[model samples]
Target: MKVQKFIASNMIEAMKKIRQELGENAVILNSKQISTARMFGLLKKKQIEVIAAVEPQPKMKDVRVKEKRKPLSRTEKKPNVRNQSLTSSVYPADEKELNNQIEELKDMVQKLSEHSSPDEYKYYPIPVQTFLDHLRKQGINGMIMGEINAKLLNDWRSENREKTEQEVYQSGFQHLKELLAGVEYGGSQFQKKFINLVGPTGVGKTTTLAKMAAQAVLEKRKKIAFITTDTYRIAAIEQLKTYSSILNVPVEVVYKREDFQKAIKKFTDYDLVFIDTAGRNYRELQYIEELKKVIDFSQDIETFLTLSLTMKEGDLADIIQSFDDIKVDQFIFTKLDETATYGSMINLIFRNRIGVAYVTDGQDVPDDIQKASAETIVKRLLKGLGV
Candidate 1:
């Protein structure tokens, strides 16, 4: 069986090259993506697959000897299947396996086709209001924001409600810009480096800590430590412990207000310290009060209130409003991979102006986060498929 491989920027291009070189009968033995050389330090990768022949032809016997030896009778030439008891069951199983593989390949091909999808393909896309509001992120001005957002809502609803890819995206950006106009990232840079990441249930504060710690150690090469006030959740302390192990960083688990100062002192020699707090229902004043006590005790530390974009925009507001009583310095957006689109953060940053310190796209630790910026925010928002 013949085998070959091909690579291209996307699956469509890869398939075209495959057809040109390997012919239509070629069967794909395997397919995957691999990194392309970096362009200006950005990650660039492409799809590729190795294809092989689908079937093998039976080998011929000595044709010349057979022709010369006989007029060999057909009965002698063919195997006596009755005596041989030919293996027939395997053929059926082979056919079944082939069909199953074909279905799997079709799914893979569909995924490849979707990766480079253009604007012509969305259904029930994000609302234009949410879109406009997401744009003017973190004090992005109003009039220019308004001009960009001009008539987008009406246009989206009237002209392209069902299938308007570009129109929807354009209007969506404008909608989100407006949301960004009100919030401020209360800068805590002038304050201490001990920043506590606080958010709702399962917002991934521990994992986010790993990302921040990794950046500090690997990029800044600074002495770093961790402190977790999240003794409530099962294995929560253990999770931070794992990061501490990988990073060779130290951690302190503070369960009481008095232990907090002692905990801070232990990590005080480090250049940076990340604190993970227990996820609490912000609306519950009692829980907030308890958390406030911890923050109050850890008063020297800066704090960032995290919000997961998976939340509806309205929930984001209630979360911020509930936590408003705390001195939130910045924001951290988590679980970006769960949502199909994430236009809401633009508004969140604007509403808060607390600089967005980090965004976690997945649970992949340091691989998922980067320092946040306005350009990064706008670019990713435009590329709404992931965190």
Candidate 2:
């Protein structure tokens, strides 16, 4: 028998290596996941390790019997049992070892199948499985789900006792809070002179902008003004004008870089100026360039990339990439009430490392918006899970 070990980044590659070395008759003895240290042990990467073995083929002469025994008649005496034993004694050790190896492999495969089966989560405690099901229903990404699963499993094992559903849910909530600890949160600080909202078409940028402006006027008591470059849609301009009229603030319409500069000069005395850019197919580089031509990005502006929670995560990621050249200070996720899946919001914040300023649930100016915090976001994600 021949035996060898192989390791690769994943199971598929490890299987390939084993097949190349051990051929089709090879048997997989065992397989496991491992982590390899990298960069002086500061980092670790996950890898797969597999063990395989194959028996060597016998020579032609050995495979051919030296003599053939004739069948004995029922009446004739049977061959002595000792003769039978002697015929099998040539490779007794090899046969015994192979049987032992096969038994061990069978045990390992049984365990692996039990752990990886479609109903595998059944092995976990009921409370843990319930929480995991909630995460899946929320559409959480696999990476984050893996981390959460590890944390929950570790806690469950450490306790060595079944925990209540609420206890397990709290554990998951705390883990999520820890993951978001390093990120910044809360709404605008009103420190910058210019507040800019940018995003693709029909993402509620205008309403969100109006909400923030209304908050400034009603709560912060700051002298705010609106500078709109959304000339492509006359209704957008009228919408801002409507909000400005209600808030009793001035609105400026700028069409060119010069107009933007002039508007900035006009609003220099105000406490803050909120600029609303046109909603175009930002996926096109030309639209982004046109935005550059119409807005003075060099000014003291804190840009907020507004996104709707109803959009798919891939589209949100692409919109974020389009604004890579622009300095986006934070995000303002709109229409939170429109979608039940909030995992994409958490995914985006974790991926981009950009914090969320506010999440709006309704179109009511300033009333439906709330400043985001790590606790609030996590609570919202874990809401109704235990029930």
Candidate 3:
């Protein structure tokens, strides 16, 4: 393997350098953002550093075939020869074409082998391989994959012959379930008198809140009231009011901290009070601080951080980290239908040590939401793609 490090002002330039020097087959091993200090550490410029490697090509084998015909005399007939090298002149054009085809075939096979699992993984049983492939296709993280692989290997080694495929599947499913254990599950229980939904913009916070409120009113037979701090968008407040009218529930629009407290006071007689917060770009610290000013975290309220499955995992992670100050109670994942991968839910649950309360699949109010659970998440992760 030939390895090289490349540093550039940005990732695009670094990748271009790698592709130029290492061909399109080069694999990126790692990349990171670094800063270079200049002028006695007074100023710094951010840059991207990348490590890439390519496998060495194999040597072509030489095969000699002897002919039975007599050798030609020097004066007989000299074959035409131009500026071409001796080796190139000896081989026919068809032979050169065949060699090129063989080289390309070898390159493709080498790339496939390199992309496959390591040699150690080959020792595992077929059932384990199936589950791992399913998990990988579901976009599960490598850390979680390693953990699951280790458990499956250990289980196989302990009772290798006694376990059936079904048993293996069950064990694998249980392993995943155990990882998400001890965290809260199910839809909003309305355990707290005040329920606050907070998340980034366009994550369907208002619609999800409305769904929970509808569930509370119809199924739980609880008197629910709506309080929205999303006064920045008139359409959002109006949307909430529309749902409020349909459910015959009272809705209050609050702007400042005092308004929030007053709305809670007014809904004292109601069984559950749902608060819809502003859904703007809360990835910034100022928005989180603004949320803190209006919503009272000290009060007995359950704050559910709404997230969209369609967003990238890194962005979702950043959003989750940004809300650390607000002390989110649990997560509510939206747009499940928009994305096939559900690993982000598991990733967030295990990494952040937080629980998931609900998952919304569509824009339909109170129709597409489901209570989140370990089994439900595991099923979604392994759905259609078998164990």
lDDT values, one for every candidate: 0.64, 0.82, 0.81
Name the runs in model 2 displaced over 4 angstroms.
1-122
Best by TM-score: 2
TM-score of each candidate structure, all chains considered together: 0.54, 0.72, 0.70
Off by over 4 Å in 3: 1-123, 160-165
Best by lDDT: 2
Model 2 TM: 0.72
Q: Write the per-residue lDDT of candidate 2 for residues 1-387, one digit (tens) a residue.
A: 788999876544566687789886676776666779999999987666778788676564564464355699989997666766643544446666876776777577556445332232433566777787777777778778778877887687566467888999999999988877787799999999999999999999989999999889888999999999999999999999999999999999999999998988888899999999999888888898999999878888899999998998898898899898999988888888998888888888888899989989998877889999988888888877833
Query: Once all C-alphas are superposed, what RMSD does model 3 give against the true structure?
Result: 12.1
For every candidate, C-alpha RMSD to the true structure in Å: 18.9, 8.5, 12.1
Q: Which 10-residue window in model 1 sums to the lowest lDDT?
A: 116-125
Better of 1 and 3 by lDDT: 3
- Number of clashes in every candidate structure? 30, 0, 0
Q: Any runs in candidate 1 off by more than 4 Å, and if so which?
A: 1-147, 151-191, 384-387
